[model samples]
Target: MDQRSELSEFLRSRRARLKPEDVGLRDHGRHRRVPGLRREELAQLAGVSVAYYTRLEQGNAQNVSVEVLDAIGRALRLNDIEQDHLTHLAKGKAKKKRAAACRPQQVRPALQQLMDSMDHVPAHLIGRRLDILGWNRMAAALLGDMSQLPPQERNLARHVFLDPASRSLYVDWHGKAIDVVSILRLCAGCYPNDPQLTALVGELSVKSEEFRTMWAAHTVAEKGHGVRRLRHPVVGELTLAYETLKLPDEHDLSLVTFHAEPGSASEESLRLLGSWSADQPVRTG
Candidate 1:
């Protein structure tokens, strides 16, 4: 991807999503040429000259100061993910050489110990491509037959969109699909030249219309606290709160833990599922 073009389009798309009234601008009540605030209006809000802001928007953002970038991000009403993307664009880091191919990251021994200790909570670790590097027994049971997938096809994002079983297993499949695409968009910005990632994009674009549409939106996301609803074949419906923690020394590896809200029926279901998983034989990855 051309960094300049990508940067320009990303900024323009973000700008077009904001409204003048959203950032305290007085409405003129006349038909406007653009959907969002005009160039001068955004410049005024960011406390920068219109010419300078225009240059930045045109992808001539070299040497932009942190203060100026922050101002622009605030003026644009960017969320955490968007703000991070803005910083990446300003630094022109997308032009960096491809990362040296390294062995797939393994779950650390301590992490495995932690997951094993959490008998009731479902926990797993995933790589940048959403491959399940490792998981506790509880998590394994919640996602049936996932371990049986070929190594290359074990990725959660690919399985969710390409495998029929994944769609059937998730109760709110559409919501998860959107989240997956958003996360992939964020990954794309960080690794624009990654051949594997590019190949994944091409495959999904050809295989699923929904993936193609969502990818075009240029959405980005950060892993954080969230809720997930699952329809387990053995345990029925389950609602779980989850948190994702990034692992240091590993590029794009995250440990995710799922918890059921206290005293809820979901909690009861989780207990039942955990018990069932314990009874089943362990799976080899």
Candidate 2:
């Protein structure tokens, strides 16, 4: 994807979503030819010249300062994630190094052991592009069996968008799909040159209309601790709180673990799932 084009479209889309009355600008009952706030109105709100703002939106501005980006973010009513995305786009690629491929890092034996020790909790390790680098037995039991999937198909985004089982696994499938796309957008800004990521995005865009629409929205988000509602094929519906922990000394690896609330039916279901996972025949390598 062309960085300039991405930046331009993102800004235009954001601008088109807001109205004059949204930013305390009075509508003088004038007929408007354009959607949202006009370029001059946004420039006035951002305390910049209309020419400068126009140049920035046109992707012609060079070395855009953080202050100016922040000002524009405020003018556009961007949230924290959106403001960060604006900064990332406006900062350009001069200071950033590109990764060639979105490959999963080697899973350390100690890390694998630690995950295996979490007998009840469903734990998994994800690398860049949300690839399922490694997963424990409980995680496979809770989610789908990732071990059965080909390495190239082990991405969470791909599973959410392309796999039929994901719709049944996630109780809030639509919300999860949006979150996956937003997280992918955030990754795209961080790793613009990753060939695998580019391929994955292109494939999803072509195959899934939902993915294409969400991708075009240019939403960005970071994975964080949250409650998830999942419907396991065997265990039925479960409400679990998940925590995302960044691995030490690893820039792109994160360990995600899920825990059920104590005294809840979900807790009992998790225990049953754990026992079922243990009873299953282990694959001999």
Candidate 3:
């Protein structure tokens, strides 16, 4: 991917999502050619000249200062992950200096132990590309036998969007899909040169129109905590709060765990489901 082109397009897309009224500009109720604030208007908001702002959007701000970047970031409403991505692109250090890092063959032993210990809650380990590294019996049951997929197609994002069954598995499929694509965009910005990531993006972009549209939107969001609602074939609908913790010493691995709030119907459902799942045979790759 061309870093310059990516940077330019990302900036322009973000800017286009915001309107004059969004940033406190009074709508003149006059006809406008574009959807969002004009170049001069944005530059004015960021306290920069039109030429300087235009140069930045053109990916030509070679000597841009940190303060200036921060100002532009605020103007564009860039989130934490988007801000970091912008800084990284501006510094021109996207290409890996060393050989591409090797992907892990399995989940770390400690993480495996951690997942196993969560007897009632569903937990799993996944890579940056949403590839399942490992999961407990509860996780497997809740997610519906993902191991049945070919090893290469075990990615959550791919299965969720590309596989038809997944459409009905999630209660709120559109919202979940958006979150998946947004997280993928964040990962792409972080590892622009990863071959595996590039291939995943290419495959999804071609295979799924929803993924393609969302990817083109250039959205970025951090994934740390959220509530997920799923319709399990066996257990009916379940709503669980999940926490995602990035593992130390591992660049792209994270531990995701889900638990229903106490005394709720969801919690009762999870308990029954976990008991049932624990009785099933475990599959190991």
Best by lDDT: 2
Clash list (residue pairs), candidate 2: none
What does the lDDT read for residue 42 in candidate 3? 85
- Models 1 onward score TM values of 0.86, 0.94, 0.92
lDDT of 3: 0.82
Per-residue accuracy of model 2 over 207-268 as CA lDDT, tens digit each: 99999999988888888889999999888899999999997798678899999999999999
- lDDT values, one for every candidate: 0.81, 0.85, 0.82
Stretches off by above 4 angstroms in model 2 are 93-95, 100-104, 282-285
Q: Which model is ahead, 1 or 2, in terms of TM-score? A: 2
Error of 3 at 172 (Å): 0.9
Candidate 2 Cα deviation (angstroms), residue 237: 0.6
Estimate the Cα RMSD of every predicted model relative to the unseen true structure: 2.6, 2.0, 2.0
Best by TM-score: 2
Q: TM-score of predicted model 3?
A: 0.92
TM-score of model 2 vs. true structure: 0.94
lDDT (C-alpha) at residue 81 in model 3: 84
